[model samples]
Target: MSPRRHRGMLLLVLCWVLLAACTAQPTTEIAGSRPVDTSARAMLGDLRTLDPCTLADTAALQRFGAVSNAGIVSLDYCLLHLKPDDRTLIQLAVGELTGPDSDRPGDPVVPQGALNIVQNAPVPGHCTRRVRFGDGVSLQVSADLLAGEPGAGLCGIADAGAEAVAGAVQQGRAGHRDFPPNSLALVDPCAVLDTAAVNQVPGLEEARPRPSVGGHQCSWGEQSADAPRVQLQHTAGEPPRILHGAAVEEPVDGRRTVLSVVGGDPQVPLCSAETGHIPFGTVAGQVEVAQLVVAVPGETGTDACAYARGLARLAWPNLPPANP
Candidate 1:
């Protein structure tokens, strides 16, 4: 054989041999391994100036009016929200890590193995803080501890890591605006998994984060078309810290019109609305969904509700009620 062809064959054989060894070995070494630090508090300060939407301290959550919002503070929670349907696989992986029989020999399922790494490997503490916004958005941030590793836990890590990287990039592009909507600005979870070399799990297709837009698209979408409206409202006794928004689906002539009205003082945009859309073929083969995002900015106090209501009214005319 020609020298170049011989080298190619040798390389291919080496890959096959490595694959065989991985397949033959059992995944028992990772279970109940020494616990790694995965705390969110440790990383909070570093990320504070990174994104205005994130609070450096839990106590500061109140200042941002997150008391009644759905709080998210763990890498696990963040992964769940970012990819809700993959909860079972992720939880199973965590269970394996925490379980007594983790080292016991079994089939080398990819998802379970990936979860084991996340549960056992250490991560910065500050990435675990839960932030809630009462309305529709809640965030729990964490670093992807196992980006280049192979195995079950690798899948989740790749997905979450890509998301974190994507989020950071998108936020940077948006200049850290307040109340950003959930745009598919993160890397494709599936592509991340595929590149990470953890594609052996059954039903792996279901665990992937499909893109809403087409090839080579940026991770995040553009800013909302309408300017955010701000409002502050008072309750009976509590030191008010509540933010609210509505994401309602309105169907129009065989099409869906999604109207999102967000209300808060100093409203922090979580994800961009103009850029957020469900991926094609994610839900029963649907390709795209229309969305409208409106921000209501300012700090919390009296008149917040009134301002929100007015904005909703304005949006109502744009959407109109769906026919029965």
Candidate 2:
């Protein structure tokens, strides 16, 4: 209660405050004191048909070193390799959609017109930055140093790549993918099955189509709910060899359909039907495949394969002819 004790306590508090301030992690602050406009993302156009490679601006990335296209990783991503010392690889994902429920807590945003660029936490030997569009869609720039390569200034390269992507989108240079008329690339996954066809499955009676970021995939109803849900994706790969359950092979209008139920639990399993329709040629042995899946929940004891076969039959007539 004396003046001496009061003075000492005040000094102690001041020291603690200073220490905390020095150790505090920096929070995200928007550059230029401005927020991005979400509407500008509309220029990117329909995600399914948009060519993600267009956003990888090689000119902007050239400052770091030589830039080379790594090719399409998926319908939603275009990969690029950056050579700074000729061994350090920078793989950039142009546009990968992260839904609203994602848990990534991104740091400081740099506003580029309508885009908000953010630097994500780096893992060992790797760094990533993202151009977030507020709607859970993002273009990520990643720099990974190969073994025995130095990691110094690795994140700086990611920042530069992210800025380049943002600039490309802002300048309206983003482009769309083109495919031949008879190619399966033109098929919309959402249109492969109608609402009525989806409703025929239990739990999706009132479900509607939710298109994936690339529009090459589609889903109906929530997977975790008590009802069964359906998902269809257009991809290139050989059909999976069914393991754990009956591997029923059937023909739908000459299309080879393979059906199987796979999961650890018998009450709830993933019923799938894979059909090959066209040639993709990415790999000598790979072909364009339509993967139709039905996830049954709880103890519904639904005839998953039967429904899968029915859906395949319904979808087969609509799919592009094989090898066209």
Candidate 3:
């Protein structure tokens, strides 16, 4: 063969070799590789007596790791730990669990959605509720009756017996209005409380400290009251539009300042962003409560108070000391 033709034949042979290697690769979707084990599923049946939170903890993961790998599934308790809000809980439980090779398509093993509805039902006092997640696990949730912990009582449990005591420590602490009754819906409980923290004291615009980023000035002010507290305002645009009645309070424990952003007329949207990024003129605030820090995004409004309040709650301390 001519020199040019020989080179061309060699290239063709290499291309064919690469194609064979690609086609020989194993297919990721193996039918019985991760088969659902009925025996493992039976083990989870008795889990109804255990606490959902406890089952979701690291210890539970360790205990059930083998079974989970064997195809005995459970809910993604980590996501539930992130935001214990009932709505978020319901969404996560009902939504898909994404990660690893465990893409088994089905509802969560714990039926949290049904339990959420029962918890919100207009019954007086606390109630115990039970939900089956799927083939593997079940959840026994003890919902509080009133707003706060002390006032909250276990009303009843639907599927599980009331006497069943499951020791599921909440993976993460609950924030303000994290799990409010159904009638109340989910209001930013921190709205009123945080507003008070941010606008507690006058001259916050001046006395507050500033955090410098690049060359721009990032100023911070605080207002706080009771459980809710608002961090200093960090605006990147024109002077933030002030809202009426928002107040700031003296710092508690000398570590954090509190702000109270009240609700009502001229409601504002805090933490507004046109795209994913907060706009140049947008304002942001943090509310630190317990273990969660809520980020409030600024929005367009005659008054920036509502957004301020939301931001304050979102940025609440992870484990703020109780008000004295």
- Local accuracy by lDDT, each model: 0.23, 0.62, 0.24
TM for candidate 3 is: 0.19
Question: Which digits, one per residue and each the tens of the lDDT, describe model 1 over residues 1-324?
Answer: 112212222221111110011112122234668532222212222221123223222232222122222221111111121222232122101100011211224423223221221222324311221121111112223322212222324334433433343244323321221211222222222231121111121222133222211111111111222323221110011111112343333333333333332332224331112111232212242222122222323422222333323333333233212231
The most accurate candidate by lDDT is 2
TM-score of each: 0.20, 0.59, 0.19
Q: In model 3, what lDDT does residue 228 have?
A: 24
- Error (Å) of candidate 2 at residue 162 is 4.0
Name every residue pair that clashes in candidate 2.
Answer: 48-214
| Alpha-carbon runs more than 4 Å astray in model 3 | 1-154, 158-228, 231-324
Q: What CA root-mean-square deviation does each model show from the true structure?
A: 23.1, 16.3, 25.3
The candidate, 1 or 3, that scores higher on TM-score is 1
Kindly provide the TM-score of model 1 when superposed on the true structure, using C-alpha atoms.
Answer: 0.20
Candidate 3 per-residue lDDT, tens place, 74-182, comes to 1111112111233221111111111111213442233222111122232454333333222222233333222323322233222232112122211121111122122
Per-residue lDDT tens digits for candidate 2, residues 1-324, read 112212221221111110011222223336666443453246577655677777777787787777787643245556676777645655454565544332265567777665677777777777777776645456566676643366646788788778888888878888886655755566887887787998987777888877655556677876343446777766544433444445666786678777766442345455668776555545564565677777666532237767778888888788877645
